[model samples]
Target: MAGTNLQTPILQVDHLSMKFGGLVAIGDLSFTAPRGEITALIGPNGAGKTTVFNCITGFYKPTEGMITMTRASGEKFLLERMPDFQITAKAKVARTFQNIRLFSGMTVLENLLVAQHNALMRASGFTVLGLLGLGGYKDASRASIEKAVYWLEKADLMDRADDPAGDLSYGAQRRLEIARAMCTGPELLCLDEPAAGLNPKESLALNELLLGIRRDSGTSILLIEHDMAVVMEISDHVVVLEYGRKISDGSPASVRSDPKVIAAYLGVDDEEVGDVLVEVGDTSVIEELDGVAPVAQGPAETSSMFEGPIADTVEEAGGETIVPASPAASKAAQVEAETAAKSPVEPKGPAQ
Candidate 1:
């Protein structure tokens, strides 16, 4: 809810594409996460949301495009060129997985401490100084413990500090994972479905924790979440993906109201599309049914990313002047006839 610097982007993804063999997982997708803001990437399943995350976090090399991370000190790193480990270690980018990735055998406190391994290793001179308890190792060890304890309290896991991470409940494990990532002192935090299985209360707490991180530490966050409640509440910007392409990008309110987004998510049966367009305030589509060409409004006027009957509906409404299908029943009958012809041998009955 607080203001963030929209002009200064902490991460820039430009024309990014990823391919698995012949399958294009992400295609020419571009978006930005501004410094100290919560940006959410959301879509229906198989929309390539996770693929974009993988490319950003170095889990997958993009087939095309640039991934740039700019730190507060003005240091810039080309993330797509970095190894996964180096992305976290040198570039100060940290992420949590869709599945929990905690060290199950380790204590909750130890899990947090392990996230600080690079710093501790530097302080200990690898292991010799640490084993000898000499030089700055003692001070560094104390500092690591202090940091671990700090995050544990923030995550509300201090009561279970000595318990094995595996022993915590599902929600607790989720919080612990975030706490572990926070211990790494990340400049950019990428979270994959942090609220996937959380109850209402846990989800509320998670929202508070994320907001606190942004407010107190100014850490930039990019999250992939299906929980619209969380996304709508915390996100300053929202980018939508559908079938490996970005379909919408704007503030939560704007994206939520975009007719293209509505069609993509709810899906338009050809029979219902004319009404749906009108319902979403795209009344100009009805002009097509009345024989008047509607004036172009924007890029969405003649372009669409949907498939099947929905695609036909959007294109017809926006693209060309054609014979009027004025009555809803006439449009439905036309679609049913086309569908029947495509599959001739199917059992024919009243349509569901």
Candidate 2:
């Protein structure tokens, strides 16, 4: 908030599209992230969620549309036009992958120090004179070390500064990845599944670390996570994506209650109304939304939209098996799932 005026959004993604041969990874997606907030992008497997992140971070140039980031200093960057390094170097965007990519052979401190290599080189005057330690190279190097130590302290990795990165635990490795990104001094941090393989305790630690980053460092985070617990706990807002399109965007509470979201999860047609009523009970309100007529009938009157082939699909995928429903009930769930997938737009007010 200190750097951003209320007038412009921090990042604006407009009609973004991407393709992989015959597959459409992302389709005409658009959204905005404000100056200071943690936004979570969530979806089931193969949702094109990662593809969108890649496009924004310059890993994949979009087939169409624009990704614009307005910096705190009121500078505007067309992220799609820039190369990957420029996305980090000039646009001040940093990222972490789903898989932790650390310099396994390097010391923990050395890994972080490397993140600030460009800054330190500039400080040393980038010449043979500086390399010979004549133009404050020693002082600059010392300062770089101190900054790396500072981030390590922040990440609670100071104790392992002298250790090889490969020697740390899985959780520590994830934390170090984040610390390394912070070393670059980014304004926007894009994390891809930071909690993918962590145990319960490790996942909770990640939650705390992410919260700390937001509270103390003022860095806005855009994360793609499948861990619902992590998403529900820390995200200020949640966006849901399915296939290649955004379906829902709102607070956690609003998204959880959306009928479209339920249907998406269950993978059923909306016309199968009465099937869900038995599970959810008297879902007449939901039925009305899907334009289905209310049914007054016996138990066997329900249709089996979720039976047979549907059940087999769910079972094979190791997902929950939803009972069959009337046309209204099925529609409600689909509607809810889609609504739940929509990501929250930035609040049109001052940053907290």
Clashing residue pairs in candidate 1, if any? none
Task: Identify the runs in model 1 with alpha carbons over 4 angstroms from their true place.
Answer: 1-6, 266-352
Q: Write the per-residue lDDT of candidate 1 for residues 37-144, one digit (tens) a residue.
A: 999999888778999989988999999999999887777889999999999888889999999998999999999999888888988999999999988999999999
> Which run of 10 residues does model 2 get worst, by summed lDDT?
305-314
For residues 200-283, write the lDDT of model 2, one tens digit per residue.
999988898899998898888999998878888998877787656777788877766665555554344545543553345334
Which candidate tops lDDT?
A: 1
Candidate 1 lowest-lDDT run of ten: 305-314
Q: What is the TM-score of each candidate against the true structure?
A: 0.78, 0.75
RMSD of each: 10.7, 13.3
Model 2, residue 52: distance off in Å is 0.5
Tell me the lDDT of model 2 at 125. Answer: 80
